[model samples]
Structures are given as structure tokens and as C-alpha cells.
Target chain A: MDRKAGFLFLSALYITFFGLPAASLAAENICHQQGLEIRQAEIRATPPNAPVTGGYLHIHNHGTSMQRLTAASADFSGHTEIHQMILEAGVMKMSPLKDGIEIAAGGHIQLKPGGLHIMFMQLKQPLAPSDMHQATLTFDKCGDVPVLFKVTKTPGQSDSAGHSTGHTHQH
Target chain B: MKKIIIIAALFIVTLIGAYSLSEYIARQLYPQNTGARMQLGSPFNLTAHTGEAITEQAFQGTPSAVFFGFTHCPEVCPTTLNDLTNLRDEVTAGKKTFNIFFITVDPARDTVAALRDYIPYFGDGITGITGEEEAVYALARAWGIFWEKNNITESGYNIDHTATVFLLDDKGYFKGTIDYHESRDIALKKLERLTAIR
Candidate 1:
């Protein structure tokens, strides 16, 4: 076989053995709501007795217009809000985003630990690890986007997408 | 040019000599700066998560890492506690005794039972402390921790608090601190130094 054809054959073989499995594995975590794409959606696993936890995800606006996530709800939580955590002058301050998080046209945003995240309170049941919990995210224009957030012990544990913010100590 | 370089070197040497002399005298005057034990924080009467009365004495006999936060805290508190658990394990490795103290800033909501339910997610070797609001705040003050309640909602309120984790020696003397979201490597090094202090 010619070098170019041989390279194509090897590339196909490599993709079959490596790329397919990863894509299929993460397929369950990725969700699509019309023009919006959500990836790496997960809820932090907390103690069975704990009443609160946090959820994280990445939202990409694949369409030509902007989208705003106004609210989120889960069957296991009585109260859910989009909250932002910021470190101001050595103080850790958390505030709810009542106006919601806005994603620009053709842009993306992350809701990760130590930054913006979904605050789940009054939990009816604990988020056990590896368990998938159903949640509905309400957007100003997109209506309701249903997602299944997999419970994880640590950030990026199930996927290699490292946290874009937080978890750093500058000495 | 050689003479100029020699003169510059001599000036730096003289500066170093003067600084060393001042540091020596200061250490002589204050023995605590020279490896002498210095206690920190005041005695406190509080309740542990185990539903038992605890005092500052519990912090003695073992090096401890203390943090102040409430159970209602969504991200910072739990994230810090989780990081502490992993860093402590890496530092201690079951070779020595190192305790972690989780002091609640919002005592009104963080009862003994509340802490018990919340702290278990970070694993063992953690002692949760909660009591009357005034008493808890007093203890936090003694340790140089500041907190304020804000954004009151119908459900509850949020607390703005210092996110530094205090490190103390076996004698309960202040050693150092690990800032919130501080790099894990530096935090691990601080814990190692604290554990080695005994």
C-alpha cells in the first residue's frame, strides 16, 4: 500500500480501538437542547446524611443566538439555584444568580467548583457516586433542557476535562 | 572593573551581616521565634459532632488542621474539606496523629447533629465543632478568623468568612495556614511541616 493509504488505514484502526470507546462512554453525559449543547454534567456526591450538594456542567451555545440559564430543578432537591462563588479579599462569598447565567452567541460557559455551580439544597436523597440523577434546566428562551447528571466523587473524575477554575494554591 | 565588582560584593556582605546581627538579637529577646513553642487561640467550651462536650484541650497532644465553615456552604466549605482530607492523607500516611477541626461559623444552623451528617463525606479523622453563636464566634475570633452573615433569605442566610485553614503543632501552638484554593503542593508541604513539628 502507498504511504498515504497506509496512514489512513492505521488512523482508522487507532480510532476504532481508542476514540470510539471514549466518545461512547461520554455520550451519556452530553446532552443537547435544540441550539444549546451541555457536556460534562455532574453532581457532586455527598454524604448520605448531608442535606446539600453542588452540581457542575459546561454549556455551549451552538446556535446563532444567546441563551440564559435561569433555573434548575431536580426531584431529589427541594431547592435549586444557580450560585456563584468568588474569593473577595481573602473571603469566600457565595451569591445566587437570580438573573441567571448568560451564554453569548457561539460561546460557552462553565459551571464548576469554586466558581459558578448549581446549588442543590434540601436534598431528599444523597447523590451516590456513579448514579445518574435527572434534572431540568430552565432557560429564558430554550424552555426546559432535561439532563442526567452523573454523581462523581471529585471534579473531572469520570472525564479528563480538568476544572477551568478554582482548586489552585498560589504561594 | 574588578575593583568595582569587589566593592559591590562587599556592600552586599555588609548588608547581610547587619541583618543577621539584628535577627540574632531579636531571637535572643524572643525565644518563641527560635523554635520555642507558642500557644494560640483561647479555651473554648463547645460540642463535638459525637454529641459530647469538647474544649481546646482536644486540639493538644496531636497536630491539628482547623477550618471554619457551615454545612450550608455549597462549594467552598465542602471543597476545602475534601481537599484537606486528601492532602492530610498524603502528609500523614498513618505514621502520626493529625486531626482536622471543622468549626462552624453559623452555629444557629450548624447544630451538632447537622455537622455529624455533613462531615462524614470527607472521611474520618475530622471533628466537627458547633455551639452557641456567641461562643463559636468568640473561639473564631481568638484564632483570628472573621465571619459575617449576609444576604438573608427566607430559607436562611449566607456567611462571608475567612477561608484560611490553620495549622497547629502538637502543643496547640500556631504554625501556619493554608489559604482557600491554594495550590495543593504548597498545602501538602505545610501539613508535612506541621506533622514533623512534634
Candidate 2:
């Protein structure tokens, strides 16, 4: 615990001295060391004036045992929930998972549209595709996994196959 | 007796083949006639995001895609809406009138502003409509939509409703329904058929 605190203190100082981008990368690397791995983390950004958005990412339990992402916190919203979307009896049902979802040993779960996802409600402001945001996911055993959520263009949308518009966030 | 048995077998095969062909032809000729299984639509009234009173009659003269969902949903709503928007963009050309109607079941919270900001984000020619719970419920019932509130939260609740996108013709007849979760190519084919047949 002391070592973790020391690392966070150094990271904060690094951010203050330099900038957020490098510190963000360093923070992600720190999160990777904590045993919970996040891949392809993206936040869906809509048009202006919208107050909320959805987030998707792949969480892998790199540790030898199972890990549970018990809760998640974000700087942008007051509330965060792990929700499930399912189609039952011809009805599309979206409901929150009261008991957090589990990541099996040596396995992973994908938080995606039309399946499981994270809901960020009461956003401080609208999410723009050009912007990046930070979210911290808490695990049952792995502690805090801070991630830099890259804003992706609206899900299930893109230009024609050949008529390509360049991605805004290459880095 | 052997000749009679052979003739009888041939006759049965021809009869079955003729029945199958006729059934195929009937489906093609009367594609809008979903009356055989379930009726497609009925009268509905609601307020559009633009704050104008609208009804089922407004969709009478243009091919429309009707879907029922809530604004606060995490995925299916936006994913399906994006898929439908892409289908519309793929099928529409030269001022073809293809309208998409998004009806919210959670009208208590899905206000005009919420929908106004949400629906247009998908694509143009789409209208977000909501109203009193009774009004929205009536519309859902008429369209054979099964929607109910579940997972209630302090902020709001998520709605369990049909995710199928109904395809209606210019005459307000039920042509068919495209399950939005289906592959985009399949949805595109149905949309293209709706436009080409028009």
C-alpha cells in the first residue's frame, strides 16, 4: 500500500510538472501492473448538448484467479453503473447488474453495445469525439485501474469502405 | 397395378410442387399483407421533438421505419438507431422519402429535449416522438410493441421493449419488420427492397 501511494504521488508530480498526456500513459502502465488489463477502451460521443454517454472496453483478468470489477468511478459523471442489455420475448431489455459482473480466471468480458456496457449518467458536459476522458474502475482484488477512455466516433457508424474519413485520434 | 402406383406418386409430387409455387407467389404479390399473422399498425398520437402534435396519419405517404425504445438506454437503442440510419443512407437517393420514427416508451423521463438531442445525432429525416405514458403505451400497443419499465433507478429506469424496426409502406401498410440486430447487409437489403418496390 505504501508503494502504491508513493507511485501515485510521483505520478501526480509528473503530471503537474509536464502535462496530462504523458502522465496518462504512465498511469495506464501503472494500471496494467495492478493485474486488471483494459483493452480498446472507448467512450461513445454524441452531438453537442447531450448530458450522458456509454462506455465500452474489454477487461481481462490477467491474474491467476478470478477478478470482479465491482464498481467504477469517473470524473465526469456522478453515477456509473454496469448494465446489461438483452433481448427477451421480443423486448430489448436494459438493466443494471446489481451484483457486479465477474471476469473468470484467464478470461475476459467485453463491454459493448447491445450487450454489457458502462453507463455514465449526469455528465458534466457533452462528450466530444475529439476529446479523451479518464475513468477509474475498481476491482475486487486488483484495486483501482485508471484508464484513459478514447472517444470513438458513434458506434456502428463510419464512411463508405473506400471513401474514408481519417480517424481523429490516431495516438 | 404397378403403373397405377407410379402414376399416383408422380401426381403427388406435382401437387406439392404447385402448392409451394403458389405460396411463394402470394407472398411476393401481397408483401404488405401481414394480416395473415399479425396486423402491423394502428392509430397513434404523440408530440414530436419539434413540439408539434403528430399522428399515425403523418406517416401515410412515405415509407417509414418505426422503432420503440428509451433515450437513457446504454446500447441497443443507439446501436440499432445507427444501423437503421446507415440503412437509410444506403437506400435513399434522389429525394427518396424514407422516414424514421423513434417512439420512446419511457415518456415520463424521455422529454422533448432529451430526445431532440438524442435522435438527430443518429441521422437526418429522423423524428423523436414522446408523450404521456398513456399515449405512448397506446402507440406501442397499436404497433404490437411490448414495452415495460424495469431496473428502476433513482435517476430513472430502463425500458424493456421491442427492438424490431417495423417497415411500413407509403399506404401505411405493414410490409415487414427488420430485426435491427441482424447484419447490416440484411437490413440494407430489406430497406433497398422497400425503396425499389416503391
Candidate 3:
């Protein structure tokens, strides 16, 4: 009994000291490869019959050369494309980016609502809240960056992110 | 004395012309409010998500919040519907009977089955409307709503549409509109005032 009690105490101490911080760190949802970092990666949960949904994230290129995000593939979607949604004079217009997006050296690009995002078309199944999806984002220079997107009901309501769609970065 | 009288007459004429021009500009700019209690839509037949044939009479008894969008829409439609759900809960508090409608612009894709599965994700009491393309277009035209489809990929398309939510009174008269991305506080207040109308 004493040995089991000691083990449980040690586990609690370890969780308080190490596990909690890791949980807090997960709020950023970042993936890094070859000096390219993707932050706040998430996919929006959709209604069961929705034909399409959006994935948003921020890309930071720390390398000295420009990188082009050319393509993306999601395990849950049959077709994935980089698309842009423009809200001009209360009209929302969306179009695909044929040439992909360019990230300058030491510059940042954000894929957000009312702006650039990943369009997941023909979903194999409906994405539910708290579900994690695996997607591979391919870049010209970085090859492929694997990311895990946390499915959220609202745009930025995952973990402690607390960033709502209403506050998406507007540029 | 004659010269003074002529100058006063010219000054009065300029004032009158300026006033008339301003009034004309106001009327041109805000034609929605100028008409006598703007009529919302003409009689039309459409299928609800419940698979029932409905007409404008469905909106005649209770104040309705109608939004024109499609299930394929990724961002705006879902966000607006979610916002409306929360706002309705807060504004009504289970006391008011407010109706919400989600009318699809892409009628070809948003069939009865499609909407039946989609509308339930949002809060309850929202009726999804879709019908033949021509009839849906006619209904949108009557409400002064605009929608157009743009082909991005060979097999995929997106729509450019008005994201405004139209508010109608219990008598089916157009009351006002809630613009997309309008402040939440203001939208809540608008719903409060709208539901208060009898």
C-alpha cells in the first residue's frame, strides 16, 4: 500500500510540473520543419451535410529564402486546395489560388477567415469538435510538413487559444 | 431697394435648390427605408427542410430572421448561423417565438436531404428552404438579394453572395437587416427590437 501511494504521489507531482505545461504549450498548435513553422493550425468542424470546410493556420519562414506553399492533402478530404475568401462591401467571395502562397524570408503569412485558408472539399466524414485530423502541407522548399489540426466549433476556440473567428487577423 | 430685394430672392432660390438636392440624395441612398413598410417577398412555393411545401404565408405570423446561403459555404454561413443561435437564446430567453430561415442560393446542391442534415447542427427552430433554381432565384430577386456562382475547379464551385440577414416583422413586412460581421451587441439589440415587434 505504501509503495502504491508513493507511486501515485510521484505521478501527481510529475503531472503538475511537466504535463500541465505541455498541455498549456499545446495551445499554439505548431509544427516545425526546415526552418518553417506552422502555428495555430486548426480545422473548423462542420455540419454533417456540409460539402466543404476551412482550415486555418499561420506560417512563419525563418530561412533566408522565399518558400511557396504549393499543395496540401488532408486524410479526411478527397480534395484540398488553397483558397482565399475576400469580404468586399459585405459580399464574401472565395477563389482558389492556382499559384499557391509565397512566404518571404523572415516574414509571416497567416491563413485566416475572411482571407487565405485551406479549403477541404468532399469530406469523407463530418468533423466533430475536439477531433484531431492529420494533414500534410507541401511546400516548394520545405518538402512536406505534417500537421495535426484540432477540430474546433468556433475558429479559435481550442485549448486555451480563446481566439474567436470575430477576432481573426485582418490584413 | 430693388437690388436688395433681388439679392434676397436669389439667396432663397439657392437654399431651396440645395435642400431639394439633399433630399433627393438621401432618398436615392436609402431607398430601403423610404418605401411604405417595405414588402418582403411575393408568394412563392418552396420546400422546407422538413420536406413540406411552404410559401410566404409561413412567415406571416411570426417575425422571421431569414438568411440566404448554401451548405457548401465554409465560413460565413456557419458563423452567422451560430451567432444567430446564440443571439436568439440571449434575446428571447424562452419567452419569444422567433423564426429563423436558411434559404439556399445553390438550390441544385442544397436539396431537402442536404438541408435536413445540415440545419440541425445549429440551434433548433431553423427551417432550411430550397427549391427549383428558377423559383429560388425569383424569391431572392423579390427580396433584393444577390447570388452568383463562380467555378474554381472543374468539379468544384463557390458562390459570391450577399451575407446580410433580413429581419421581418410578424406581418411579413421587411423591418431591417443585419450586415455580416456587424457588432454582436448591435445585432443582439436588433433582434431584441425585432422580436418585440407585434
Scanning candidate 3 chain B in windows of ten residues, the lowest lDDT window is B30-39
Using lDDT as the measure, what is the rank order of every candidate, best first? Answer: 3, 1, 2
Q: DockQ of every model listed?
A: 0.35, 0.37, 0.52
Q: What does candidate 2's lDDT look like per residue over B43-100, in tens digits?
A: 6768998788888786777888888877776666777777788778768764575789
Ranking of all candidate structures by their DockQ, best first: 3, 2, 1
Question: Candidate 1: how close is chain B to the reference, as a TM-score?
Answer: 0.80
Answer with 1 or 3, whichever has the higher lDDT: 3
lDDT of 3 by residue, A1-171 (tens): 699999999999999898855653343233243467676787889887886899988788887888899999988899999988877776788888989999998889988766899999988899998787878888887666677777777764342345443333111
Off by over 4 Å in 3: A1-34, A157-171, B1-36, B152-154
Which structure among the candidates has the greatest TM-score? Answer: 2
lDDT accuracy of residue B152 in candidate 3: 59
lDDT of 2 at A71: 83
RMSD of each: 12.9, 8.3, 8.6
Candidate 1 residue runs with Cα over 4 Å from true position:
A1-34, A156-171, B1-38
User: What lDDT is obtained when candidate 3 is compared to the true structure?
Assistant: 0.83
How many clashes does each candidate structure show, in the order listed?
5, 0, 0
